[model samples]
Target: MGNKILVVDDEENIVKLVSYNLEQEGYEIITANEGKEALAKIEQENPDLMILDLMLPKVDGFDICRKVRKDGNTNNLPIIILSAKEEEIDKILGLELGADDYVTKPFSPRELIARVKAVLRRVDYTADEEKQEVLKTGAVELDLKKHQVRINDKEINLTPKEFELLSILIKHPGQVFSRDNLLGEIWDYNYHGDTRTVDVHVRRLRKKISEYSEQKHIITVRGVGYKFKED
Candidate 1:
C-alpha cells in the first residue's frame, strides 16, 4: 500500500500544497485544519506517519504531540512537526516532545517530500526485518522477523525506534553507551545535531518499555550515561 500521511495545519494554502505534492508522490494524503480536528482525525485514520504544525487552534502541536505520545496504541507512531517558529528552543522542544522530525515553514516542498520518504524508508526497513523471524532475550521473544515482541508470550506494540533500540540493548546485554554513542550507532545520521536527540528517544524508549515490565529495562549511570539493564 502507498504510504498514508496526515498533515495538520491551520493554513489552507499550506495544506493544499503539501497534499498536492505528497499525492503526486503517491502518498495518500489526509489533512486537518486545526489541532483539535487533527487529533480526532489521527485517532480515526491511524495514518502511517503524521505532519503536524506547531501552531494551531485549540490543542496546538506540542499538546497534540504529547497526546499521541502518551496514547498506548499511537505512542510509537512517527510524527514530524512543521513550524515557522525559528527559535532553536522551539525545535528542541518539538523533538523533545517526541516528534520524529521537524520542518520549518516557508520551506521547500521537495525537502518535505524527501524527509517523508526517508522516515518511511527507515520504518519499512525495520518492519520488513521483523516479519521473517523472532528474536529472543531470556524469556522475552522479540521476533524482528515476525514483528512481534512477546514477554512470556504476551504481545506488545513497539514503535520502530523503540524496537530497534531494544534490540540493540538486548543483543549487547552489558554495553554502557553514552547518548552520543547511541546516536552514532543507531541513528543513521553521521554529521551534526544535538546529542539530546538520543536523550529524547531514550526517554521514549524508557516510557514504552515500562508498559511491558516492572523492572527497568534501561539504566542510567550518574556522571556517565545510560546502559541496558545488565543485572
Candidate 2:
C-alpha cells in the first residue's frame, strides 16, 4: 500500500467516493465524519496527508487546519481542503489557514487523485532538498538539513511553509516567479483559484525575515509575482 490518507467529510457518499478512488491508487484510506473525529484520527493515525472538508460537524475545517498548523507535531502535515463552497473568499481562507490545496465539490476524481499525487511528490522533493548544504545570501543563512535559519549568525524560527517559500526564492535569486508558479512549486500544484495564498505567505515571510535582516531580499515585481533581489 502507498501512504495513508485521512478523508474527513460529513457526507458519507463523498467520503466513500474519495476513499474508493484513492484506495484504487494503492493508498490506505482512513475516514472521519466530523471535525472532532478528524482531529482525533490525525493524532492517532498520524496520516501522511489529509483531505478535509470545511463545514464539518463538531469542529470546523478552519479550526482544524489552524490547530494542526499551530501544533508542532503536525504543523507540516499536508492538508487538502475539499469543500462545497466555491466562493473565492473561502478558498483564500482555507489556504491562509495552511491548507496545501483546495478542491471544490463535484470535482473530478481523476483531478483529485492527481492533486494527491502532486502533494505527496512535493513533500518528497522538500525532504530531499533538506539534505543539501546550508544556503546563504548576504548576512542571511538557511541550514536546510538542520531546518534552521540565521541572520548575522543569530538563529531564527520559521514555520515549515515559510521556510519552504524562502528556500525556493533564495535558490533562484533574481528570477521572477508569478503567483501561479510559486503555488505550483511550493504547494506542489498550481492553484489558480487561490493565488491569495501566495500573497499571504509572502506577507508573513516578509514580516518575519524583516525583523532580523535589514536586507529587503523578498521583492514584489508589481505585475509579476515575487523574487529574491539579485544584490
Candidate 3:
C-alpha cells in the first residue's frame, strides 16, 4: 500500500482509467462519483492527493477546492483538477482556488502521473543542508521547519505553493528568478510554457501578505521574473 489518492469524477470510465493507472504505480486508490461524496471521503480518507473533476453533482469541484483550502485541517492538501473546461479563466480560477495543477479531459495518463509525482515531491521537499530554521527579511519571517510565515509578527495563511515561492525568493534577496526558474523550482516540473501559473500564485501571495504588512517583499522585474526586495 502506497500513498492513498482520492479520485472524484462522475464519469465511470474516467474514474476507472485514472484509478487503473494510479494503482499500477503502486498507489492506493479511493473513489467518489459526486461532489458530496468527494468531500466526505476527503474528510474520512485523508488522501495524500486528489484528482478532482470540475463539474460534479451537488457541490462542484470549485466549491470543494475552496472548502479544502479554507479548512485548517485540509489547507495543505494537494489538489489536481481534472476537467474538460479548456478556457483560460477556468484554469486561472482553479489555480487561484489552490489547485496544485490542472489537467484537462483527454489528458495523457503518463503525464498526469508525472505531475502527481512532481507535486508530491514539492510537498515533501526539504533542504537538509540549509541550517537556517527561520528566514527573516524586513517584516516577513518564514519558519522552514514549522512550515509557517508571519508578517510583522502576525501570522498569515498561505498555501503550500505560496510558502515555497516565498521561501525561495526570501532566501536569495535581489536575485532575479525567471518564470521558468520559478516553475521548475516550485512546481518541480516544466509547465509547458504556462508561466501564468506562477503569476496566479504570486498574486495570491501578495494579497495575503499585504493584509499584514505594507512592505512589498516580492518585486516583479519588468520582463524578467521576481525577486525579494529587502528594503
Candidate 4:
C-alpha cells in the first residue's frame, strides 16, 4: 500500500493542491477540512503521517496535536504543521506541541515535496532484524535496531527525523554537531535554506527527551550545533 498521508486544512484549494502534489508522488492522500474531522480520520485511518493546518476550523491545529499526543494509540504518528503562521513563536509552539515538522504557507510545491519526501524517508520503518543498536544517555534510551526510543521507559514516539537527529547525538554523547552538519545528516540537505530548521527540530527533540530530565537532555552550543548530555 502507498504511504497514507492525512491532510488537514481549512482551505480547500490548499488541500487540493497538496493532495495533487502528494498523489503525483505515489502517496495515498486522505483529507479533512477541520481539526475535528482530522482526529476522526487519524483514529480511523491511522495514516503514516499527517499534514496539519494551524488555523483549522473548530478544534484548531494545536488542540488536535495535543489530543493526539494524549492518545497512546496515535501518539507516535508523525505530524507536519502546514500553516501561514511564519512567526517564530507560532513555529515553536507547534513543535513544542509534539509536531514532527512545520512548514509555512506559500510554500513551493517542489520544496514541500522535498520536505515530505525527507520526512517519509526518515520514517520508513526498519526491518525487525535491524533492531540491534542500543544507545542511551541518562534516562533516555534508543534502540536503533528496534526503532524504539524511550524516556524513563515511557516510549517517545519520535518521527524519523527526530530519531535520526537524536541517534546522531546520542551515539557520540559529547560531540557537538553544528547545525549545518545536522542538516546534512538528518535532512540530507546540502544548502542553507533555513538553518533554523535544525534549531526547531532540536527544540522538539529536547522537549521529547526532557520528560526524563528537568535540566535538559540535549545541550546547545551558543555558536555551534548541539550535543547529547548524559548528566
Candidate that would win on lDDT: 3
**Would you list the rank order by lDDT, best first?**
3, 2, 4, 1
Candidate 4 residue runs with Cα over 4 Å from true position: 125-129, 151-160, 190-193, 214-217
| Model 4 clashing residue pairs (backbone) | 130-145, 131-145, 131-146, 132-145
Which candidate number maximizes TM-score?
A: 3
Ranking by TM-score: 3, 2, 4, 1
* Candidate 4 lDDT by residue in tens digits, 43-92: 89999889999998889999998999778788768888899998988988
TM-score of 3: 0.96
RMSD of each: 3.6, 2.5, 1.5, 2.6
Q: Each candidate: what lDDT?
A: 0.78, 0.86, 0.90, 0.82
Give the distance in Å from residue 97's predicted Cα in candidate 3 to where it truly belongs. Answer: 0.8
lDDT of 2 by residue, 13-43 (tens): 9999999999999999999999999999999
lDDT of the structure predicted as candidate 3: 0.90
Flag regions of model 3 displaced more than 4 Å: 126-132
TM-score of 4: 0.86
- Give the lowest summed-lDDT range of ten residues in model 3: 123-132
lDDT of 3 by residue, 174-228 (tens): 9999989999998887575389899999999998988998778789999999999
Cα deviation at 221, candidate 4, in Å, is 2.7
- Listed in order, each prediction's TM-score against the native is 0.75, 0.87, 0.96, 0.86
Give the Å error, residue 52, model 1.
Answer: 0.4
